[model samples]
Target: MSQWQQPGDRRTRGRVLRWNLAGWILFGLLPQAVAVLDASPARRYWLLGLLVLIALCHTVVVNRPDNPLLRHGTYLHLLALVLGSTAYLMDGGAAFYVVSLPQFWLFTRAPRDAITLSGAAAALTVFGGTLHQGWSPQFLTGNVISTVVACVAGAGLGLWVHHFVVRSNERQEQLTAALALTQKELAAAYQQQGAAQERERLAREIHDTLAQGFASIVVLAEAARAAAVNDPVRCAEQLTSIEQTARENLAEARVLVGSAPESGVAAGSLAITLRRTLDRFAQDTGLTVTAELPDVDLDQRTRVALLRCTQESLANVRKHSGASTVGVVLTELAGGVELEITDDGCGFVVEDSRGYGLDGMRRRLAELDGELSVISSLGDGTRVLASLPTHSQDRA
Candidate 1:
């Protein structure tokens, strides 16, 4: 019932009670009953009455070990009975004292309690025997010596058992505390990992959508400013393109923040979306753009991934490539789809290039179980290939 007492301690005490009960019946109760048959009527009645009292006390101790008052009281009462039985029966009653020794440890909580009570019980047992036998040599040699030896051995064993239980309880408490701390640390690590992953996702989304849109607006504005005086119509068209790009970027921002139902590219067919992007790029940059886009059935996520990859590839081509023409192709492979964007522009060393755009494309494709590969060398045209397996293809 105490905070330090575990269920295991209760079970151990229960087992001790069972063993003690057997000892009482075998050595205490049954012997007293047999002796009652050969005694005077007064002694017989007295032993019978004592046996009933002992049985009742034993039952209360066994049935309600948690009740401290009842358990301790019964233990004290049993010790008194042992003393009385020793005084009345003398040598015959000494066996009851031996059998009752375990109760001192079993009933009390603290080691001192057990030691104090046991020492008192030993002294009372000796006094009761001396009262009847009056320090006779035969009684001193047999009963007195045996009682002292038994008391000493019982006290030593009780101290060892008490210390062992205390150490076991302490160890259990430490392990429980350690396990709780480990669980808290593991949960904190998971929360940190989730936060980091969410940050990375937001960065990728901003780069693919808003950042690319702003870059396009900058390019259009520059072209519009240069053509304003000489060619008003061209300048107006560039300004209009800039406005459209800005509006689209605003929509993308809404989608990112959960205001929009879906991404801007997610509303239409993948082919139509890619063609529109190509047309805008060709009009804005005055670059020769050729495309072979075909409709492919894809989930919203796959479509978004492909569109981002295409946009990133074209943006790279426009900024880095001196080539005047670009080619875009989307085709269905066996069990998969592949998009290839090639430019007849000045290419750089792929390994030496340190850009987040390329890394972002790779990560986006990887999320859809896809892959991106850039093949290019100096003086050679660059080829950006993105491939994703369709669900049907995956099953096949």
Candidate 2:
């Protein structure tokens, strides 16, 4: 959309018009004031009245600077033309008012409008000068030539100025609109970043605390059942440990649901959490899993991004890859970190299918200025690779 014009340009134009009117009062009317002293007493009074009336006409319209009445139509120019021509015929010196005629019509009016009105005024000036000074061939020839030249040149210059102002204002408006749109987009992006960060924080907390706690409970129960008849005392100890784990998990779940600081596996290093995730995946899916993870400290956002990518990749393999084995490898690069998940499975064509799971993983990584790539083919295998920058983390 085109931007709106600024008030500063309008005010600048208004100031120029005011100065033009001031010039007419000081230079234009003073000449007529001097000419009136040379007239007969009876004609002098009428000439003075006409001059005052003409000045009043200019004053009335120019005082209402920036008014749409004069901008959208030619009423103000027509008034100037009539009053100026009448004053010129009454007092030859009052012809100075003729200069304002072209200026008013050309400043904002259309080119054809300024040209037509200026031409009429030029004709009237020559006619009035002839009748006032008495007709002569030399006078008529000189007046016509000079009047047309002055009026045409003045009107042409005024039209050019008007065109320049219109173009400059239009460009300024467009720039202003584009700047506003950019600011809005930036604000929306910041908001989205804030929401995504909150989501990742919660997800990391759940994976570290509740999900890990549940996995331990399942393993303990399985151990307890195996020893129930053979070793009753050992099974009793296992039950007690399960009860304690469940109670701790319940408290962690409460903290997760409420507006409280998260308490979970996040307190330790990321490698510990990944180890637990690897173990749980192997225990649940019965898929032989191997991992080569780095021991490094990462900012909160990067840690969350990496953990989520791992969780999503393994989940996909367990549910869809139909793979018997999976491998997870994480390493640090020159300025960033990379994780790769590979599985021998019944993979599908990347172009044919996509679900929210994959899209969500990409989105989560993107929020951290990271990327996720999945390569797969039918009867082949699937590999998910995620890369995240370590230095510039998004706090929002």
Give the root-mean-square deviation of each candidate in angstroms: 4.1, 8.9
- Which residue pairs show backbone clashes in model 1? none
**Per-residue alpha-carbon lDDT of candidate 1 for residues 1-396, written as tens digits (9 for 90 to 100):** 222234375677677678878887888778777866887787778777777776777777687865554544456656655655744653434566677777766666666777677777777777777777778898787766776777788889977776776788788879989999999999999999999998999898898889999999998999999999999999999999999999999999998888987765755479999999999999988899999998888767778888999899888987889879999999998888999999999998999999999999999889878999999999898999999987633220
Cα lDDT tens digits for candidate 2, 203-270: 75566557756876887789899989999987887788788779878988888889556444374467
C-alpha RMSD (angstroms) for model 2: 8.9
**RMSD, candidate 1, Å:** 4.1
Residue 30 displacement in candidate 1 (angstroms)? 5.4
